[model samples]
Target: INRLSSALIRTSTKCINALDALRSLKDGLDQHPSITKEEKERLLNFISVARQEYDEIAKKEIQKAFVYSYEESAKVLFDNYLDNIEAYCNSTKLKDPITDEEVSPDEKLMRSIEEQIGVSENAKKSFREEILLRLSSYARKGRKFDYTSHERLREAVEKKLFADLKDVVKITTSTKTPDAEQLKRINGVSAKLISEYDYCPVCANELLKYVGSLLNR
Candidate 1:
């Protein structure tokens, strides 16, 4: 949609420019002593209609561009959310065995799922790196920067990892409780990451510092 909108705008702009050139030619023609007033009036009216059409087209093009941008942003957000969910599931190590013929997902199939998840994670990492580079370039130019994009990227990465981990857990009729200490550590780590996003000048730097602190402890 964005591409289509851009094309429309480009085409409209060109048309408008051409119309302007035509009007200039008409004005030159009107200056001729031999030209009749009727001919001049006709040419001016045609130019007026053409200009009006160009303005309308320009407005429609702008609307289309805005719609395209909004849709694109929504899609990106959804993708990021799914990725985060997968990462969270993987981190939790919630998986079920398939050999018993009781689990929804079979062991072999689950392993394949994990492989796919890894591919997604690698892709997310690549995207995150690209965004970071872009953010850095913008920052150097003294432009405003937001961590929302990176936050979404990280969420997607973690969710994809979690989906694979979910396949590893054993399925049972009753819900099983996890170790409180492990859960606490996971929460703590996540909180630290969130803080880094909210407060740090450079997200990468903050992440490194947080990790270093964790290691030291």
Candidate 2:
């Protein structure tokens, strides 16, 4: 059961990671001005399809893990039952029946044990089926992506503008040192670009300094 649980966790992580990668790719497309609007739309649609497919795959993996765990649990229970029955029979030295046609004590005990095991297995199977039905229903519900989507969009915009503004630095450097207003414009553009991406102030400052150095060179 522990091993099966771990497998399920690993499977879920893999699915999440794959979805994250697709999301990152979509964000990159959104930020790239070189990519046409139509192409971006097509790529976004592809990502959507990939997400749907991954969701289905994750559902199936969860179901498979549950089924395997339950089956293993049943087998362990059955084995423990057999071990307990054997111990009981060994501890109690019961003889065979006096009459040749009569059933022996050991035979009777084996029959009872088998009947009990059958009952337990049936109960487990019914319970497993019920849980699976509930899981299927739960999986059909929609999930929220607002927070993640917003973050990805912000990051994409930041990356796109940063690349675009690199050219501005080069152009300014080709001429003499930029005046106060020119520097202000450059700082404004950098600030606006990083703000959209939600970069921390320290990181944004460092990025601006790097760009300033490039312009000075």
Candidate 3:
């Protein structure tokens, strides 16, 4: 699902990393706690068009590639990541494009962007209070909050993403006796790598075979 995502989406031919980052940000806009409600809604509403276009263009392939194995855990990690983005955006200061700063990760004031996901002012107030309370509790326990704040959550997300990737790209276990359908699928995935991703036939099949071996183990 790496470059396949790029090819399927509009990330190819353009800077794939940039567009992928936007898509990721776009996905997290809902849970970011720093942006005001309005800003969040605005970005989501605006980005929805691009997301729709990507989806339409890659409808079939995406449907094939994007099944989640551990959906809930992955979702929780994603939400926390989005929250980090929001926190960063709300800092009222932008980092120098050339230099690294404290945030690697906005409350717009938190309301503007939070609104995009239907966070009301009342809910925002309550959420802010709750988060502060949680932070204090964590401090009391000598725990720092960050992306890896929840070890179990991180492990779950990693497993989920990896499993989904294997499902998408791992060829059958025994190519020697692959059934007709599997042979067809293997051919399709190989053709995809060769024609779309510019992998040579030999290299693509070799990669697929390596993947198949891992899955077999």
- Which sections of candidate 2 miss by over 4 Å? 1-16, 72-217
Error of 1 at 26 (Å): 3.7
- Best candidate according to lDDT: 3
| Per-model TM against the reference | 0.25, 0.27, 0.27
Candidate 3 colliding pairs, count:
25
Two-way TM-score contest, 1 vs 3, winner: 3
Pairs clashing in candidate 2?
none
Q: Cα deviation of 107 in candidate 3 (Å)?
A: 24
lDDT (Cα, tens digit) per residue for candidate 3, span 100-186: 564343344244434434557667655445555565678899987542454433333344354445554344534677888777667
- At residue 164, candidate 3 shows an lDDT of 46
Query: Model 2, 1-217: lDDT tens per residue?
Result: 3333333365434322444466566656755799888888888899899977865553333222222323443344334333434334445433323644533234343333334324354454343243334434555665332211233222322333333344654454233467886566545544554555454454444444444444455
**Lowest lDDT 10-mer window, candidate 1?**
166-175
Q: What's the residue-level lDDT of 206 in candidate 3?
A: 54
Please give the distance, in angstroms, between residue 204's alpha carbon in candidate 1 and its true position after superposition: 36
Candidate 3 residue 68 C-alpha distance from true site, Å: 13
Sort by TM-score, best first.
2, 3, 1
